[model samples]
Target: MKVKLMTALCFLLINSGMLNAQVKDQKMGELIDQQFKFADQQYKVLAKNLPADVMPKTYNATTDKVVTSNTAWWCSGFFPGSLFYIYEYTQDAEILAEAKRRLTILEKEKNNKGTHDLGFMMYCSFGNAYRLLHDPAYKDIIEASAASLSTRYHPAAKVIQSWNSSDRWVGPVIIDNMMNLELLSWVSDHDGDKKYKEIAVNHANSTIKNHYRPDYSAYHVLDYNMETGEVLKKVNWQGYADESAWSRGQAWGLYGFTMMYRFTKDKQYLDQAIHIANFMLNDPNMPADMIPYWDYDAPEIPNTYRDASAGAIMASALLELAQYSNKAESKKYLDASEKAIRTLASDTYRSKLGENGGFLLKHGVGFLGQNSEVDVPLTYGDYYFLEALHRYKEWYL
Candidate 1:
C-alpha cells in the first residue's frame, strides 16, 4: 500500500513552478484534473449530506455514522471552512450558498469563551469569508472571536489556556494553541488593537521556552503554575506519551511558527519552523510518501495508521516556509511539501467517488489514545488539504 502511494505522489515532486512543464506533461495534468474534480464532487455530496446546524468530525464506517458536533465543539469550524475552500476552488453557486449558511451559524460562536479553538472555529470560517468577500460583517465576527480568545490568556502564564482548569490538568496550554495566533495577529494588523499582536508574540515566545524539548520536538500539553509563572509539568493529552511527538501537534507547531515569522518577520520563529521541519523530514519513521503516523512514538511503528490531516497541515506550512527562506533552504522545504501534497492527492489517502462519508481525504487519526475518531475521515483533513492546494497554486502554479 505504501509503495503504491509513493509512486502515485511522485508527480507532486515535479517543480510546480514549472507550470509550462506541467502543461506539457499529460500525466501531471491528469492528476491535477482528477484532484479538483474529486474536490468538487466531495463538496457537492457533503453539502447535501451534512446536517445544516451540526458540524462533522469523522465518520464511523462500521456504524454508518457521521460523528458530529454543535457550534461549541472545537472542530466545528472545519465543516464550513472546507465548504468555503471548495466554493473558492469550484465557484459553484450551490457550494457558495451552503458555505454562507454554515458560516452564519458558526458566526454565533464568536463570543464563546469556554474553548481555545476559537481560531479553528471562528478564524477558519469567518476569516475565509472576510478574505474572499471582504464582508464587513465577517470582519466584525473575527474581531469578536479574537476578543473572546484573548480572554483565555493568563497574564502570569503568558500563554492561552487550552482547556479550563479540568480535573486532569490545571490551566493547560497545548501545542495546538499555536494555531490561534494567526487570528490574533490578523486582528492586530487590520486596523484593530495592538494588544492582540502583543499577546500573540508573548505566547509564542513563552511556548518556545517551555513547550519544546532539546531536540525541538514539542509536548502536547503544558500544565502551568500560573500564580508562580512556572511550567508545572510537560504531559500528553492527545499523544502516546509525555515525550512522544503527536503528529498533528507537530504540524500545528510547524504551521503556527511559520505563520508567526510571516506576520512579524522574526528570524527566531522562522528558525523554529525550519528546525521542526528538518526534524520531521529527517525522522526515520516518516513514511516514504511523507504522510506520518498518528503519533511519532507509537509502538506500532510501520504498521500504525497514518494521519493524512497532519500531512496536509505540514504541507501547507512548508509551502509558506518555502517562501520565507533563502533559495537553497526554500527548495528543500518546497520539495518536502510537494511530496506530501502528492501523497495526499493519491487514492490511498483520498476517498473514492461516493465513498468515505463524502469527504475528500481519509485515514486521519484523531485522539486514538482516547479511542475517539480513530483512523477515520476527518473534516480538518479535508480543510487543510484544500488550504495546501491553494498555497501551492498561489506560490508555484
Candidate 2:
C-alpha cells in the first residue's frame, strides 16, 4: 500500500508540472500573436513615412520629426530586417512589398567597402530576403557584400577593422562588429570560400582574447595596431566610464558569440557566450525586469535610463542560447527570456500602434555618453524585439 501511494503521488506531481507548462505556453502564444499584429500595423505606418531613398532611424515626438539615415549608416539594415520578421509572422503583403522596395535602395551598398557595416547593412536586409524567397539575385548581392567586407580584414591583427583611421583609434574594432560576422559566415558557407570563414574565426578568437575582461564582460572598443597585430588600448566609447559596461555592447557580444557557435559548433564560442550571458543576467545592477540600464555600471543606478534595445537584443540571444544549453540551463535561459519578452510586450516598453514614430519599442539610448538618440525609439530596438517575438513563436510556442 505504501509503494502504491508513493507511485501515485509521483504521477500526480509529474502531471501537474506538465499541465502548468501547457498553461504557460498557451498564455505565451496569445501574447506573441497580439504583439505580431501590433507590429504589422505599426510598420505599415513607418513604411509610408520613410523617405524614398533612406531608412528609418528614430523619431523625436516632441518635435514630431522622423529622423532617417542613409544606406551607409550602421543601422540601415534593421528597418528592413524588422519588416522581414513581421512579414514572416503576419504574411502581410504590404510589409513584404515595402521590404523589397527598401532592398532596392539598399542594394547599392553591396559594393561599398569603405565601412565595416556591410554585414549589418547588407546581410540583415538582403540576407533575410534571400532566406525567405530563395532568390538567386539576392545571393549575388550577398556575395558581393561579403567580398566588400573581406577587404576590411587585417590579416596581421586577426580581426576585421571596424572603422577607418580616425583620431579616436588607428584600427578600432567595436563589439558591435561581432554582429556583422554572420554575413561573412553565411558567405563562406554558401560560396565555399574558406577565407571568409577563416577571417571570421580569427576575428572571433582575437575578440575573445582582447575584448573581454576578467569577469567576461566585454569592452566596447579595442584599438588595434593593424601592422603588428597588437591591441593598442581597451576602452568604452559609448558607456558611462571607460570601464563601465555598456548594455548594448554586452548584448552584441552575447548574440554574436551565440551566432558563431551556431555556425561553427565551436565549444569555445558557446562557452564564451554562456559566460557573457551569465555576466549580464546575474549582474547585481541588472534590473528586476531584465531590461538593463544604458550602462550597467552607470552612476545613476535606479535613476539611469533603461535601454529597450539592449533588453530586446539580450532576450533574442537568450532564447537562441537556451536551445543549445543543458536541460536545466535551458530552462533558466528560457524563463529569463520569457520574463524579458513579457516585460517588453508590456506598455512600458512596447509602443502603441501608430505611436512612437511607428517604431515597436521605446526608450532606447543610442549613445548615452554622447547624448545622441537618448530616450528615443531606435530601429534596432524594434528589429530585435520583433526577432525575439518571432523566435518565441517559431521555436517555443
Candidate 3:
C-alpha cells in the first residue's frame, strides 16, 4: 500500500510539471503573435507617412512634427530599433532594406565632431541591427564609432568625459554615461581590441565605487576633479535639485550593471544590479505597478507624474538579471517585472491604436531642459516596452 501511494504522488508531480511547461509555451506564442501584429501595423503607418530622406531623424508625435532642432543624438536610436523589430518579427524584406538605408545615413552623421552619443544612437540601433543581420557595413560603422567614443576617455580622471563642450558639464561624468559602456565592450569583442574593454571595465569600476549611494540609488551627475581624479560634486541635474534620485538614473544603473555582468561575469556587478533593483522595488513610495515618478522621494506624491519609460526599460533589465540570479528572492523581482509589463499593456499608459498621433506610450519625459515631451508619447518608451514584452515572451511565456 505504501509503495502504491508513493508511485501516485510521483506521477502527480510529473504531470503538474508537464502542464506548467505547456502553459508557458502557449503564453509565449501568444505574446509573440501580438507583438508581430502590432509591429507590422506600426511600420506600415510610419513608412507611409515619414519620408525616406528623414529615415533616422527624431520627430515629435504631439504635433506630428519633425524635430529640426539640434538632433537628439541618443534618442534617435528608437526609430531604427523599432524598424528592426518589425523586420525580425515579420521577415519582411522591405523593412530590412529600409533599416539598412537609414543606418547608412546614421553612419554618415557619426563623422560629425560634436556627437557625444555614439553608443546610444548608433550601436543600440544600427549595431544591434547588424548583429541580427550579419551585415559588414554595419560592422564597419560600429568600429569607427567605437574609436571616436574611445577618444573621450580621460586618462587623468580615469573616466570618460560626459560632453564635448567646456560648458557646465565640462570634465564631469554623468550617470547616463554608464549606459554607453556596452558599446565599448561589444567593439572590443568584435574587433579584438583590448583597449576598448579596458576602458569599459575601468569606467564601470570607478562608477560602482563613487557614483552609487548606500541605498543603491545614484546621483544624476558626478563632477570629477579632472586633474586629481577626485570626486567634486554629486548633483541631481534632472530631478529635484537637492540630491534627489532620478528614477531613470536608477534604471540606467540597474540596466548598466546587468550588462556589465553579462560581459565580464563579475559577481560584484551582478550584486550591485540586484541591490539597486531591490531599492527600487521595495521603496514605500513606488507605485503599485512598480513604475516610479521622476524622483522616488519627490514631494507632493499625489500630483507627481510617473515615468512609464523607466518602468519599461527596467523591466527588460530585470528579466535579464533574473536569468543570472540563483536566490529565491530573484524570482520575486522577475514577478514584479512581469506585473509591470502587464500594467503597461493595459489602458492607463499605453496609447490606443489611433490616438495621440498614433503613439505607443503616453507619458515620457525628454530633455528636462526643454520639458518639451513631458507626458507625451516617446520613441524610446515604445521601443523599451516592446523589448520588455519580447523578453517576457522568451523567459516567462
Candidate 4:
C-alpha cells in the first residue's frame, strides 16, 4: 500500500510538470501565430494598395492625402522589417524575394546625403536585410552606408554630427543618432575596423553625458562645440518647447542605450537605460499599453494619441534589459514590459482582419505636427510589435 501511494504521487508530479510545459509552449505558439497573421495581412494590403510603379522613395501617408516626397528615408526601414518578419515566420520564398527587391531599391539611394536618418533608413532595414539574406550586394551597400555614417563622426566632439550642410546643427548631436551607432559597431565587427567601434563608443558616451536630463528624460538634440567638445545647448526639436521630453526620444534613448549595453556590457549604459525606462513606466500620463504620445508634455489630455512604435521599441529593449540584469529591480521592469505587451495584444490596440491597413495595433502617431498617419497604421509600429511578440515567445511563453 505504501509503495503504491508513492508511485501515484510521483506520477502526478510528472504529469503536472508536463502539463505546465505544454501550456507555456501553446501560449508562445499562439502569440507567434498572431504576429504572423498580422504581418501576412499587412503585406497583402500594402502590396495591393501601394502600386509597384509608385516611387518607393517618395511615399508619405498624411491625414489629408498620401503625398510624394523625395525624402522618405525612415519608412524605408519599416517596410523591409515588416516583410522580413513575414518571411521569417512563413519561410515563403515570395516574401523573401519581395523584401530583397525592396532592399535593392533602397541600396541605390543610400548615399544621397539628404537626411540624418541613415540608421533607420539603411542599417536597420538594409543591414538587417543583409544579415538575414546573406547576400553580398546587400553587404556592400551596408558597408558603404557605414562609411558614410562614419564620416559624420566628429572626432573632436567625440560624437557624430547631425545635419551635414549648415552649422545650423554644425555641432549638434541628437538622441536619434544613438540608433545609428549599431551600424558602426556592426561594421567594426564585420570589417575589422577599430575606428568604427571607437566612434560608436565615443558617440554613446557623449550622449550619456550631454543628452540626458536630470529626470532621465532626454533632450531631442544637443549642440556641442566641434572645436572645443563643449555642449553648447540641449534643445527639443520634436517635443514641446522648454526642454520637454519627447516620448519617442525617450524610447530611442532606452533602445539605443540598451543596445550599447548589449555590445559593451557597460554598466553606465545599462543604468541610463533603466533610468529612462523607469521614468517612462512610472509617468502618470502613460497609458495602460505602455505606449506614449509624441511628447509627454503635449497639451492634449486623455484624448492624446499614443505612439505604438514607442511601446514596441521599448518592449524589445526591456526584454534585453531583463536578460542583462538579474536583480529584483530588473524583474519589476520585465513584469511591466510583459504587461505592456499583453495590453498591446489585447483588443484595445489590436486590429481586426480588415481595418487600419491590417496592422496589428492602431493609434500609432508617425509625425504629430504634420498630422500625417496620426493615430493610424505605421510600418515600424507593426514591425516592432511583431518583434516584441517574437521575443516574448522566445523568452517566457
Candidate 1 ranges beyond 4 A from true positions: 1-30
Residue 372 accuracy (lDDT) in model 3: 54
Report lDDT (CA) for all predictions.
0.84, 0.87, 0.72, 0.70
Cα lDDT tens digits for candidate 3, 1-397 = 2453355335433443343333333454675576567666665655555565554333465367644322345666667777787777688888777777667656665554355577777777877698688878777777777778888887777788787546675567878888888888998987647798888888889899989888888998888877778887788888765467788888988998999999999999999999999999998888776767767877856355577788888888899999898878679778878766766655566555545544566666654445655555677777777778777766776
Candidate number of the best lDDT: 2
**Which residue pairs does candidate 4 place in steric collision?**
none
What are the per-residue Cα lDDT tens digits for candidate 4 across 1-397? 3453355335433443343333333455675677586667656656555545332322233342222223245566766767777787778787777777666667765675555567777876777677677877877777777777787777888988876536577577778889888877887888747788888899899888888879999999888788889887778877766478788788889989998887788899889888988898888887654667668888864445567678878887788778777688678777777766765665455666655544566656665666555565566677777777767767766
How well does model 3 score by local distance difference test?
0.72
**Of 2 and 3, which scores higher on TM-score?**
2
Q: TM per model? A: 0.92, 0.93, 0.87, 0.85
> Relative to the unseen true structure, what is the C-alpha lDDT of residue 141 in candidate 2, on a scale of 0 to 100?
94
Residue 337 lDDT in model 1? Answer: 79
In the predicted model 3, the residue pairs found to clash are: none
lDDT of 1 by residue, 124-207 (tens): 998998888898989999999999999998888788888889778877899999999999999999988899999999999999
Cα error, candidate 1, residue 316 (Å): 0.5
Model 4's alpha-carbon lDDT is: 0.70
Clashes of each: 0, 0, 0, 0
Ranking by TM-score: 2, 1, 3, 4
Q: Which ten residues in a row have the lowest lDDT in candidate 3?
A: 16-25
